[model samples]
Target chain A: MKNFTQFQWLKYTVTNIPDGFDDMYWKKSGSLKISFIILIMFFFGIIAKDRLYGFQFSADYERTFNIIPYIMKSIILFVAWTVGNWSVCTLLDGEGTIKNIFIYSAYAICPYVIQIYINLIFSYILVRDEYIFMQLIEITGTVWSVILMFSAVKAVHQYTLKKTFTAIILTLIMMLIMFIILILFMLLIQQILIFISEIFTEIIYRLRA
Target chain B: MKKFLIMFLCVIIFAFPLNVNATYNYDYMRNAIPSQAGYNVKNVLYFGMNEPQDIFFSGENFYIADTGNNRILVLDYNLENIIKIYDKFIFPNGKETQLNNPEGIYVSGEKIYIADTGNSRVIISDFNSEIIMEIEKPVSEIYDQNKTFIPEKILVDKSGNIYVISGNITTGCMMFSSDGDFTGFFGANRSGRTAENIRNYFVSDKKKSRRKRNIPTGINNFDISEDFIYTCTENSEKTSDIIKKLNSAGKNIFSDRNLHFGDYQSEYSNSGYKPPKISDIDISENGNINFIDSETGHIFQYDKNCKLLFIMGNISGQSGGFEKPSAIETAGKNIYILDSGKNNITVFSETEFGEKVHNAVDLYNSGYYAETLNLWLEILKYDGNYTYAYNGLAYAFLRNGEYKNSMKYAKLAGDSELYNKAFQEYRRIFLKENSGKILIIIFVISGIILIKKRGEKF
Candidate 1:
């Protein structure tokens, strides 16, 4: 939007996650800040207190979506996305390092974190009568954060907008692959535990006989 | 702008896309409670009933299908005394016979159609306990051998066409002629085309074969309203199209009201438990459709236009509530609910405030909004939080050319569309009455200001 310049993502807010990444502050400042951003992202759930704010939650809002698993999934997704883009950008002769990609990508998610906290406060002031005001703010926050993330990707990779968009699309596919690998790894560990336990039981039974 | 955003959100909720509103109150004013209808009910716990499934009221009497008793009990409406126990009936050959598991009964002025389900026949008997005709399973080549004509619920139209719904049958209600001939199936529930079903149709045949096909649930009960027959089915997964209005040609006529037919999202939290099931449907003399959900035991009362009016009965099994609501039929202004689980009938008579609300709705529906406005206002006096009364008053005022009052109530109701209409009317009246005078005053003031500015410059 022409008014995109109005929003400043930096200055000690959740947007600093994306800001630090976009500015490549994670490399010079530290990767630990990325962890702080991800932690803040997780804190979106705690800010979303159960049934406390009537503006957003329904009567059965508790069961609508699991917040913990959702935040974890988001964290996993961005991690996979960073790895995906870094692996591709290496071959494409892109500019951003893996650290730069990870840090900046986390920064993209920071706006949502900041926006939800603001929304939580707004929910307190507004009654059910003024829910639309709260919802519009949430939607605006989401759209703004998406724009920030897109720009962060574009700036960190030092690529054209077209290349950045394509890279984001490929990163989604890589995230899926990463999810499958994670699930398979868990299953493999489970089978090995089962096999080892069975062998131990059989040996114990034979000796007792 | 704030109102505009809320209006959009309300539109999205009512449109019922993606089941989001199912979880949230999309209707700002549309709370789970429809009305402030506190009833003065008298529970009739009459003895000698074994799992009565259906009840019909005609004249000063009502017929209860005493299913386990293997008989139909005709009782006086006011007296509450059983007039006759129609257990023994003389056959055509002058042989005495008795009904076996008669689940449903529809009483006309002179005739009664009893669905003797276990015997697999619909017995047409007169008030004198004389057997007129017995409609057994049709003997024809077209009839499927495995399909037993076990009529669970029977509805006979004014034109001698009998519609019977059998247990576990999804094709439609079985249509029979007056002579007990199989006409065909009528008002079949249409199976929705889902992405999963479509994909399964194309993918591995074995995988698809392993999955149970989604059969349209059987129509639990049907009540004839005017020229159309309204049927209610108990499909827990789908709230859409659970209730249908079928014409003579067996086509659904009430397609516009596919959404908002029942409760959007069930509040039931018990996993693996069956969702709400609409066991019986009844239409009042004033054309209010009442649906009794057996699972939740909540009586969902909707207007003829399918707008929900009141939700009575609770699952909590209180005095006015029901253990298992089997049937609901309205007698005059009073609603009689048969609870088979409790082995009793709960009769609910509207409170003074409820009667006023009903009168207002009646006047509003008949396009006599001016007459209803006073009644709606009276309803608000009793319960200030009642939103429908506000909505009714708004519409009535709008129609009565009282635009300011209309706009005020519309805002209270959170009805944006009606608010806009009222606002438009207000604007028109204001412009028509004072536009010229206001314009002249503005011009005179501007002229004086311009002259003063010129004087200062000079």
Candidate 2:
């Protein structure tokens, strides 16, 4: 084979490699997996929102739980963020599929496991006294999280240090493209729905009159 | 093949839970709905071509974290959309023109900081979105020294230090120098690093399941104050979201898991009841917190002590109240709530009573001593029963060195309980000066005695 140019080499390294992104070879499956993860995240978000605001949904506790719209907003935000992250990983990490990105986005949960429990037992007890300790824990979590993310990115991209860097840049561009496409699609869908709803309402009103 | 298997196993072992002695209980806080009418929408300010994830307001302009559109939507004071596009920097090949997913947006001093989440880097640009500088690659061990970690939100302090949230949701907020140096990091789970058990909780599969399968509990959103950082956590125990106060170094000064809404218990067994979620939180310049509930469209306000002060907005139809409110902010006497579902912004003016109470606070925040005094005086004219107005007037007089006036209003602000702290400070100065008055009284008495004695001698 002819020697690859820097451009060609970079592309080969980021997307064409198989070690890191072998599973994503099945693009459709990868995308499905990501969708499922997103669903789980959404459910968890709801649970968190309900718990945070102390919403029991009881007629007795209706006032506390009526904050569903706020919870929904959080869920939507979480979905958007996770999707963005997955889209980037899939396109650039040599996986080039939504499925792999979805699988890896679960990696975020790794750090939360520690954060939640520590918060449960220690956050309140430590109070002002253990604030410094809490800060350290946070720093450590970030460091560990970085390590985990690096491994995940490396596994999916299967590239050298230089190649992985290139994948990151490419993935960003891909995410941008995907984001724009999704937005356009959503806008189109919204406009069409609005138009149809208006026409249907007009017909109903006219018939009644 | 055996060697490869061994390496894979080692990787798994390496990533295993590092902390294990931690106990987690999600049943402590009960989840339940507090009311039927729920929260009312304040206002919704809608813009951008697609889903707006994060938004920043500075001066007369608003910047959208238009995650869906993969670009930042610029808006003017009238909420009109502005165009900001850039096409520079050739990637891997000859590909150029247009940026990738610009997720998080931060504008400061003519420079815009973008998380550019897709690129796994932070990009700094001019107001026009032109690429100025970038932290594309991890140069140091500051953030995932060895692997590629995604960068989320970005913040630039008054001192110009750049702070980026990287890693995942469970980790604490990370920091970096303006020049792209990995200065330090803070705010993970409580318990020091010596407690390996604490670290284990962060990496446990069961814990992950609870977070993924259950509810999220960790630092998700944060805002910086002059001396402290206010942050919110997505808690699993169905109470209220946690509000954390951190020092300048990212150390937790105090954390209130249930910040605003009082002790609420939710009956989660029945699927009918959906608990309220705190979608986005905001802190006004004066340190008042406005947290929006996505489900009910209610905006809850809390003081620095995490006490519930007021719940603005009532459930209603259409854009008047809220369909699905996302974010909140305050400008002057108006509160703006962004209703994403209705794609409209609902605006609410402060209550007459709330406005009167805030005038004093506003003057205090803006450092207008005379003006603050005048405003408080004006408020007192309308309603003389306002204790806070008196207290505020006392503070104004104190700031202006009107001690007597300060004492008068200070007592009204509940001098013993409310202004007691400030009164003590004033007392210190009053005592030192009291000696001068005592000397004058003594001199006058002696002079009177001398005049009487001279008349007796005559």
The residue pairs that clash in candidate 1, if any, are: A17-A107, A18-A107
- Candidate lDDT values, in order: 0.73, 0.56
**Candidate 2 structure quality by residue, lDDT tens digits, B1-458:** 99999999999986454321111111112322121111233444555345455667766677766665677676666564565533344334444545566556778888888887877878777764456677765565455656565676667788778777664635576676778766766565442234444666668677655542331455656666675666665453545336667777666665445243422433445543335566667776667776766655557765554534355563466446666665565655566666555555566666555665565565565677667787778766755554445756877777777666675676544443323434445556766879799789999999999999999999
Which sections of candidate 1 miss by over 4 Å?
A: A1-209, B1-30, B33-35, B261-274, B315-321, B426-458
Local error of candidate 1 at residue B327 (angstroms) = 1.8
Q: Write the per-residue lDDT of candidate 1 for residues B1-458, one digit (tens) a residue.
A: 99999999999896555310111112333345434554556565665788888888875788888888888888887636888888888787888888899888987657889999989988888877889999888776656778888888888888888888888578888889988888888888877568776787687978777887867777878999787898988887777667888888988877764455555553444453455688888888888888887886667776667666666666545566577778888888788888787767778787787677677788888888788887887887876777777888889999889988997888777676677677667767787899899899999999999999999999
Question: Relative to the unseen true structure, what is the C-alpha lDDT of residue B185 in candidate 1, on a scale of 0 to 100?
Answer: 83
Task: Give per-candidate clash totals.
Answer: 2, 68
Residue B81 lDDT in candidate 1: 83
The TM-score values for the models, in the order shown, are 0.66, 0.45
Superposed by TM-score, candidate 2 places the C-alpha of residue B37 at a distance from the truth, in angstroms, of 15
Error at B26, model 2, angstroms? 26
DockQ, candidate no. 2:
0.01
